[model samples]
Target: MRNINLVLMLLCTTLPVALSLIDGLVPNGDFEEGPKPSQMNGSEVVDPHSIPHWELSGFVEYIKSGQTQGDMILPVPKGHFALRLGNEASIKTKLQVAKGQFYSLSFGIARTCAQQERLNLSITPDIEGKGWGMLPMQTMYSTEGWDSFSWGFFAANNEVELVFYHPQAEEDEACGPIIDVVALKSLSLPKTTTDLLKNGNFEEGPYIFPDTNWGTLVPSNIENDHSPLMGWMVESLKAVRYIDSDHFVVPEGKRAVELVAGRESVIAQIVKTVPGKTYDLEFYVGDAKNLCEGSMLIEVFASNSTFYVPYESKAQGGSKLVLLRFKAANDRTRIRFLSSYYHRKSDFSGSLCGPVVDDVKLVSSILHA
Candidate 1:
């Protein structure tokens, strides 16, 4: 019967892709699977469904590693292939996810020809009012020519479509960024602890690809509800770098945040407090040991109290503990941290780097005394 065949086709198309919604890379996320020869017109992908586990539109090209475009060799972050999205081009995929849960999408991108490249991300059917976000790519955080970025959103349905679109159309149809390593991970809500702050240890966050050493960037102005850093909010104009112990030096736990954008990068969280109570805010400040050498300053603010902790970095990895005593002015307190100056690698790599913050804790002074 025609009805039976229609049902069978749908199951075959989606079942394989829906297997693991847990952590790690999505199916064919690295673009290791290439399109058939019949589906290609030179480097440009002719068929929309040629790339397995993905759909393409507009002027998308399937680029192999070391391919040349006007003497510029296209570099793939990890695998042998990557997708180049030309002007007005886009690539997307569908997956099964738990409804009402928060998720973060991680991917790597390299600017090829576009001077001002940015991408638009959207999910459907639209769930939480604004099911879309536009990430600005003007700032290059990593010196490796490409940077990994993460975006967080809540899933409103059992199945949702995730899309990455290049909104600006350049003069040349092929002028755009090459994107690879598209990954998705569900975030468990951070639990409250005795530290007076949620996720203060920086343990839970967006998924990091095991193959890459360069940490992921959590974009700026991301609110707490849609932040990849769990309970913290990126309240500045530039993004904050999320580093892991496997690749970079961590001050405390397995994960930490580097305020690489100087004053433009800020992380903050709101916490409940007792009015007129004195508390001690304790945390660790260190370098990621990425050859970033300079005099670093970490500015911290808690309600009416403000303090600056200074650290002299010789490039090698080291950490210092700082304690700030402050009085809570109201029932709620706002805590914030930012780097005072921008820093780059002393090894002449031109990579952005800064101080690392971890193991942040706040407790009543009398309790510890």
Candidate 2:
């Protein structure tokens, strides 16, 4: 009596494959995309008869013929995880569910650059640290294309997470977030299974407060010396490549952030304390026309041992994505990336070329999840 049906697909790599299929992994090795088994006639994808509630980690890579937004090309967790990145396509997957059963989350995206593709669609709340919080479960956008779009969320938490906000435009083409579908099914509590994660009824698009997401998801740098926190892109306490020049060479043990180039690097870093409690040291600041233009707001004082944050130079590149609410005796101190607290104390200038920080995520000033 556990027919937990799950259908994961994004087909069209040109095949004759078919079915409610399930099971696929290899998230990313970059093998062309989808449709294999000698090239066509099905060599895979076809194992679903409803029996998986949810379980898909990340990267399985596949996008043959290219229509799907590749990432777990086949890791079947049908209980739900659609998010093809609609503004879609850069690759993202996150989950942490576990409740009394009944899961169904959804968010089908589509983007070509609907006016700069602000594709900045955000709504966070899968937070799990403040007295039972699960207040976000809303999203469904896809007007039609490849006719790929589907949404259906109703979770009580076996777990939950699906954050994919895209805005790395310069010519764009992470291609086809064109999700074909997203699934999740588990319902059998005629009396106690009705909260389907209640209060998550949909409709709350626009709360980017996660430090503005820094230039959104960058590339095309101009340089304020770099620091939309560069997603905490660190290195150089000893140096070798961690030599972190311009700070956007990402690849040191991943928490994940990709957007590189040279000429304006520094990008902040520091989080080795938790004394007297006063945390909320957010990060963000972007600008670029060829090298800085506008935006840079700083505030990191752990006893006034250091401070710096001045970014201004713009034709395009945005994010002060700021958020600093402090009160501390010491969190172990340190949060810097040059600007050197105006070095001389305050005449700090501009054009250091920065802007590009991805999910440096740290919300525990008092614990929200």
Candidate 3:
């Protein structure tokens, strides 16, 4: 009888876990319900109860589809409703999460009535001061339409609060970015032999809108250790420009790291590998600006091996992928991409031309015998 009772208790405990995994934790994240046409004017706030499943604070506007407000036309990314948070306004929702499990948060955001729109996102009870993360500021010219952004964080508590608010806004312009299509899902860690580099696609970084439209790494004036590229470091004489799909032909997703801002530049990432094992290194190289007069060169260094590959911008319009095989002599190997070629001093831009790199992947090539 005791064993049967124990079996029943185990079944009860596991059923909830199974159900939670099948359905998302966020309720009404698509904003398909409970968004009345906001009658409030400038700086006027909305009631929290009006929007079901969302806790609102400060001034916010709930706009239905096809609604227009102050030169801003509301278009839903998923359903017939969306949310617009003004400056100093915030929206939050409590979600059930497995403690210490990895989860990803993704949503669609669009700028409205402002140029440099910025938002602060956090999953609270702050874990090691990483609870607060900034959504890369957006600009009018950066995205053609609504763009989806995603981020990953570890759940520190069984119940976590997802909070988003505008951190900065232009003077007198409080209405910031429009948000919709929020999704939160549990994530599984990659296999031990898989590539362990974070932000290998260069998709995670500080996007400085308007000025450069992306993050640029200037050696003498390094903004921060990891702003443009999260898990990489820039060691160069001048600067490394962060290129986006809008301006340049990105090899993979929407962004790539250019090796030159003014002169020679280098980007490196340290990855863990089993010593005495062979690993394969693969990456894409191309011309970011397509304005170089001569051949662009890229030097790749993995562990104890170094190889130089040249690419012609005029011949190959887009990026080309290259693979290199090397043996890991140490537990930690520093994979480096260096642009050493210097353009002629009189060639208009004065040694400012270099190669672009993206879609970097490093994986074990041979299994241990």
Give the best candidate by lDDT: 1
Summarize candidate 2's per-residue lDDT along 1-369 as a digit string, tens digits: 233322222343212122111112213211223433443222222221111332222221122332332342322112222323322233333333334322222222333323334333211232222211111112111112211111122333433454334434344333223232332222232221222111111111111111111211211112111211222322322100111213222222222221122222233335555566655655443332233333443433433444455655343434345555555456555554323221110223321233333223334465532
Of candidate 3, the 10-residue stretch with the lowest lDDT total is 218-227
| Range of the 10 consecutive residues with the lowest summed lDDT in candidate 1 | 13-22
Question: Residue by residue across 176-291, what tens digits does model 1's lDDT show?
Answer: 88899988888888886778988888988888889578988998754223888899999998899999999888988899999999999999999999888889999999998889
Better of 2 and 3 by TM-score: 3
Instruction: Report the C-alpha displacement of residue 172, candidate 2, in angstroms.
Output: 20
Q: In terms of TM-score, how similar is model 3 to the real structure?
A: 0.60
Model 2 ranges with Cα > 4 A deviation: 1-96, 99-110, 116-156, 159-303, 307-369
When summed lDDT is taken over every stretch of 10 residues in candidate 2, the lowest stretch is 198-207
Candidate order (lDDT): 1, 3, 2
Candidate 1 structure lDDT: 0.86
lDDT of each: 0.86, 0.29, 0.65
Off by over 4 Å in 3: 1-20, 23-25, 36-45, 69-72, 126-129, 138-142, 169-174, 194-269, 273-280, 283-321, 325-331, 336-369
TM-score winner between 1 and 2, please give it: 1
lDDT of 3 by residue, 53-120 (tens): 78887667766777876675665555687787876788998876677766556566777766667777
Question: Positional deviation of 342 in candidate 3, in angstroms?
Answer: 18
TM-score of each: 0.92, 0.25, 0.60
Instruction: Please rank every candidate by TM-score, starting with the best.
Output: 1, 3, 2
